[model samples]
Target: MEEDTDFRIRFSSLCFVTDHVGFCGTIKSSPSDFVVIEIDEQGQLVNTAPSKLISKILPEPNNFAKKTKLDLQNLSFEEGSNQEVSIFAGCSGADQYHQSGSEREDTISDGTSKGEEQTVDDLGTLLDEKTNELLNHFACDIKEKWNSKTELIGSSPEFSLGRILDKNQRAILHSAIRQKFPFLITVGKNSEIVVKPNLEYKELCHLVSEEEAFEFFKYLDAKKENSKFTFKPDTNKDHRKAVHHFVNKKFGNLVETKSFPELNYSAGNPNVAITVRFREKTHKHRKRSLFEYQDRKVIYTDDSLRLGQLKGNHFDIVIRNLKNQINDSANLKDRILEAIENVKNKGFVNYYGPQRFGMGRKVHTDQIGLALLKSEMVEAVKLFLTPEDLDDPVNRAKKYFLQTEDAKGTLSLMPEFKVRERALLESLHRFGMTEEGCIQAWFSFPHSMRIFYVHAYSSKIWNEAVSYRLGTYGSRVVEGDLVCLGEDVDDEHFPNNKVHLVTEEEESANTYAIHQVVLPVLGYNIQYPKNKVGQWYQEILSRDGLQTCRFKVPTLKLNVPGCYRQILKCPHNVSYQLKEEHDTDVKMEGSHIDEATLSLLISFDLDASCYATVCLREIMKHDF
Candidate 1:
């Protein structure tokens, strides 16, 4: 064996050397310079060998390193100076020691300083080993996790191996890397999880894009030739094949089977809602002239040609015709004047007012009257316009004659007679007037029609006419804790004189009179005195400082069937006044107070006169 002098090297702030030995020949600078180690000490020409080189070799996590320390040391003189150097020692415990400065420093070791430097140098080597071990640990774990040769535990969170993969590492070589899926795929603020396994389908859809999924379902439906599709586990494979074909044909990509079920079941599709608006037009009234009257001082359309749609000239002829028949007398002139004013200003044209024709409150006019006017007009038109007269320019137009004749006939003859008759009768009955035709004719004017319709259409009057009518009453006092009026009180001959007047029998009797009897209408109630009838009578009657007033038995009685009795009596003459009986009945019903009313003790701040007056008004509004 050959002995060599000290040989040294340094890396990552570490330094080391072999033991000193004697060597005869001078070492030459050469590119092929190298240290060779062998089991047989005599094998190589190299004079020295180093264990330091073997210790410096890096452990490979992914693959074994081909180059050894001896190969690195043997580089040629020029090549050594220009060579790329790499350290491969495993990480050591000292590597955890933090560097002194904030900025990173180079890993080069210094060899000149002896004792103090040696400690730091060894520390550097330990640090290098520590770092190498750490890096190797991570790399080995990654390789094992991403081993595609074995099946993965799919449900494990660690299946996402890319999360731990270093940025500098290439992921393409590993098929086991988990695919990334966005948690949300909405254009708006909404979010949803996308777990689709089909890469093609996933690529087509955004995490939020629902359209692609819809299209996928539609494609499935179309593949079935527009047939209604029902999916079962057995058919899933077939369905998946069909889907793959169609998606590939249309989208230039194959879709995975797992996505089919979800896509088919997702919400149908989104639709837009639209709204439209419109505007309405308003209407106005129309008027016409009847005729000229009193030698042209006034006009009259009422007799022959009323202003309603008649030509102006035709109207004038009608006036002349009427005057001619009257011999142009003063009486005729006056009648014509009245007729003209009534038709134009008073709304009497053709016996139907302008107010009655349109949508407004129809001037209540009898259909019968309108029909009569139409018949009159038809007769007049036929009388004046002979076939020869029709040849004149004014009367020559057969169209106008035909149209006007048809209108007149429709107004007069086409309406069902029964309907017209009922309408007229109703109008008359509403006004509380006679429904006789003669009576209707007398009140056929527009003014009268206005009043007639208003009264006819009033709901209150009609309801009452068919209902109970309350009448006047008499004043009486309670006797022996009860002043029982017989159920036959409704019978006109029922004796009220025999019932003892409480006012007359003052000793031990409650003196009561009609302090003010209230009348009430249906569905109403009037307040009454409590069960303490004596206090009611004393307070309502004597409190006013007078014992009595005009006590008269009312002329009418309750028409309703029942044992009607006195339910309550009020002592507060202050609130009592002359009132109708029905009103009192209504007020009593409403308050649950009757002649025998016992619940209330309160009194109104009123005197007998005022109470009587107020009560009377209430009665009129209600009972009467």
Candidate 2:
């Protein structure tokens, strides 16, 4: 566990937050030794539990129903006009809550409940008598069943879904649809999702204010579109009260739904309307997830590596198997504990971690990214094909492919699980290994992977800026440092890219702190800082062979708008358990009075894009 001084020197992540002496230990000695759990935007712990549910296993009616919100709440009417369906919101997290592993309490609409099993009888009940004629499960041409449900159910297909605002969950549901029934594709009018003419209504009354109800109709009048719907009528108080469970569980109030009974029971008077039409254009984010993200306009395809991509998202991490450093101090454990406390309190530099740079590989992705930026496709492809990890089997395959230009021949020797390599090879096999072919081969990757190299190169520039900030200004809020309107306003749905520099007056007033300060990741879209750091940013780009970085690569059809990240990161709820392992080796190198075997179980919660390894680096004082 030695410090990678070379990387630190090059990337500019060379400084520590604390002045305390540091110790060293090995990390990820085993797979279980290091564990990471993602905390999504809702602050709920994300796991594979949702996939384990029987409903998610296949694309059946239950599969669609599983994610499709029981939220038939969007439908309202012109106060005087009956059966004129308008959409309204429920008093819940319509903005924040999408199909985020939430299970709604209310059963199927039309109120007679069968289980998740999509039987003929259940279909008949759900579709109001048309489904029996429409749904044919056992028929010879029974390839796609969900299609029949769409036709029979018409505009009220949301009964099959208990969706929220989580785009990832929507993607998961849509993926199932695409897998089973490839024909569920198509954006509706308004470029969202199309709705059927027949609207299905299910009214389980809770309560909403008279004014909220009126405003609800107004919102629907202006913003009515397909995929955003709910049709619920006031059934009873208990069912409405049960709406509490549905609201709390599914939306958690991310999207404000005025239709919920409890929100404003006594709006102006002592009461409000119990029976009502509630419509909310639910397809806003859901369809955006389906279609908008294909261009990756706002959100990344993968779990976000960038800061606050999943707004408020964080990580719950555990680091174990900590080897005690050999030292003269009588209290080595105390020293280690003190270091951990410093990291907990003082925080660490929010540098992009080595994983972003492709640490284990012989060549880093940032190098490849820079190559791409320079339009050196051959160099970039060669860098990508380079081998690492001290005798990986792919080395032989890569060697044969590069030497012979035989992508298909190399595949037989290549490992099946090496999907990126396989994909590159397949593209090359089809497109031939010309310069254009090489660029296209890179394009064959998912948008995220294709964009990642550029992101990494930008990350290197960001890291350099961070290093300059810490090293020159010393991690303090200074005059001309960039600060957001408030805190980090990186919500993808509604981003606030606006930033202002701290003035001398503001700095004197202590208006903006270091935590509030930000550094650009460097791109065509982002504005640089106003001070010397900004000058460094410009100089860095010019040094990289461009006066300004190109955000678009027309050759690759890639567009990378820039982003910002915090300069410093502090972990939350930090705690540690120091214990000796069961069969740990006790070291007694030269001089030891009373030192026994030692290990640490260090745990912390870090916000999205803050590296846990960087936190551990601060504690361990080893850059590796």
Best by TM-score: 2
Instruction: Give the root-mean-square deviation of each candidate in angstroms.
Output: 53.6, 20.6
lDDT of 1 by residue, 1-624 (tens): 111111111011111011111111111111111111111111111111111211122223222212222222222211002111111111000111111110011112221111111222332332246533443444344335434422112111111111212211211111111111111110000110001122233333432133544344333312221233222322244434554443333322112222222223324431211111111111122111222121222232112222232211111111011221223334433443343233222110011112221211111122222222223323222322222222322223223433553322222322111122223323333443222332342232234332232222221221221111111111333332333333323211223332333333552354443322122111112122223443444353343332332221111111211111232222121111111122122221123233321111111211111222112112111110
Residue 349 lDDT (model 1): 6
How much is the lDDT of residue 501 in candidate 1? 30
Taken over the whole model, the C-alpha lDDT of each candidate is 0.23, 0.51
What TM-score do all the candidates reach, one by one?
A: 0.12, 0.55
User: Candidate 1 at 438: error in angstroms?
Assistant: 11
| The 10-residue segment with the lowest total lDDT in model 1 | 185-194
Q: Residue 433 of model 1: what lDDT?
A: 29
